[model samples]
Target: MAWFMGAVLLLALLTALLAPRLLRLQQERQERRADEHYRKQLQAATDHAITTAVRARLAEPVVDLHITIPMRVTVGDVIARALEDFALEVPWDHAAAMLRHRLEFRGHARWPDLITDVFDDEEDHTP
Candidate 1:
């Protein structure tokens, strides 16, 4: 009877000594899982924002043009140079004529005129 009681007391003491360590480990694991979940959510949101911005930028209208000019060298042969670029929206009507003049006077001739022609052509082609 005394031996049975002693074993029971020993088991209770061991359980008491180990319970706090087990509880602490479980709590740490839960916190780690929560942190991982939050990081994943933040990364997903950042990716979505970047994708949206890229799509918006791609949706903007862009035009590409290529120009070539040739020049004769004094010492040797002829040289040819090519220029290529893009143009965006430009308004070119009577109401916006002054704006167009200002832009052209600033040496943006090819760009402004090309953009204006594009808008005009689009309007004419629209049904």
Candidate 2:
């Protein structure tokens, strides 16, 4: 019948129109997953390198060192300030208090706990 033929033609037309879009969306999802995996891999590698360098420096002989601390502001904090009545500026000694708070509260939460792996020998250690 003509109606049955028209229904089949409409279904085929819809499939032809939607198939490429569906395929493109699937590809984009795959690409995003790949990007995230790559980012995590890169971060882990950077953390390892930094940890090794710090450990190597600490193992060296004592020397006077000067450190310039930076004020790191997060986007979450900025958003919170925009939403709430948070003070834009705190009282003096904020820097010192922040340092103390980080050392006391956050110092123990370091990941990959040991700087040097137990299985690593001095000769095979990364610097």
Candidate 3:
């Protein structure tokens, strides 16, 4: 009887030592999955925004126009980099028009200002 009780005590001690590590590993795995999901969502949003903008520009006749607009991405840095990359292939006028369309599609009249306002808030900002 005493031996049985001792074995039970040992098992309990081992379980207590191992449980936290197992829980932590599970938590880390969940977090990793969440991050991957978020990245996918961001990429999808970016692609959609760009496509919308291009379509909008194509809807109009090609003509020279000076328009300084923001990219569809919610982050200024990302928008700047995307604009730079896009400018390599697309003419400035077309690119600007597309960006404007994308911003409108995203329900923001001005993408840069809207994005800045969104991130500047101290509250829980999830878009």
Q: What lDDT tens digits, residue by residue, belong to model 3 across residues 42-85? A: 44444555555545545766455664343233333334444454
lDDT of 2 by residue, 3-75 (tens): 9999999999999999999999999999999767644443333333344444555576655555322223222
Top candidate when judged by lDDT against the true structure: 3
Judging by TM-score, tell me the better candidate of 1 and 2: 1
Tens digits of per-residue lDDT, candidate 1, 1-127, equal 9999999999999999999999999999999997676444433333333334345545655554353221111100000000011111222232133323433454434432233231233344333
lDDT of candidate model 1 versus the reference? 0.40
Q: Which TM-score value belongs to model 2?
A: 0.43
Cα error, residue 56 of model 1, in Å, equals 1.3
Per-candidate clashes come to 0, 0, 1
Each prediction's TM-score against the native? 0.46, 0.43, 0.45
lDDT score for candidate 2 against the true structure: 0.44
Candidate 1 TM-score, C-alpha based: 0.46
lDDT-wise, the better of 1 and 3 is 3
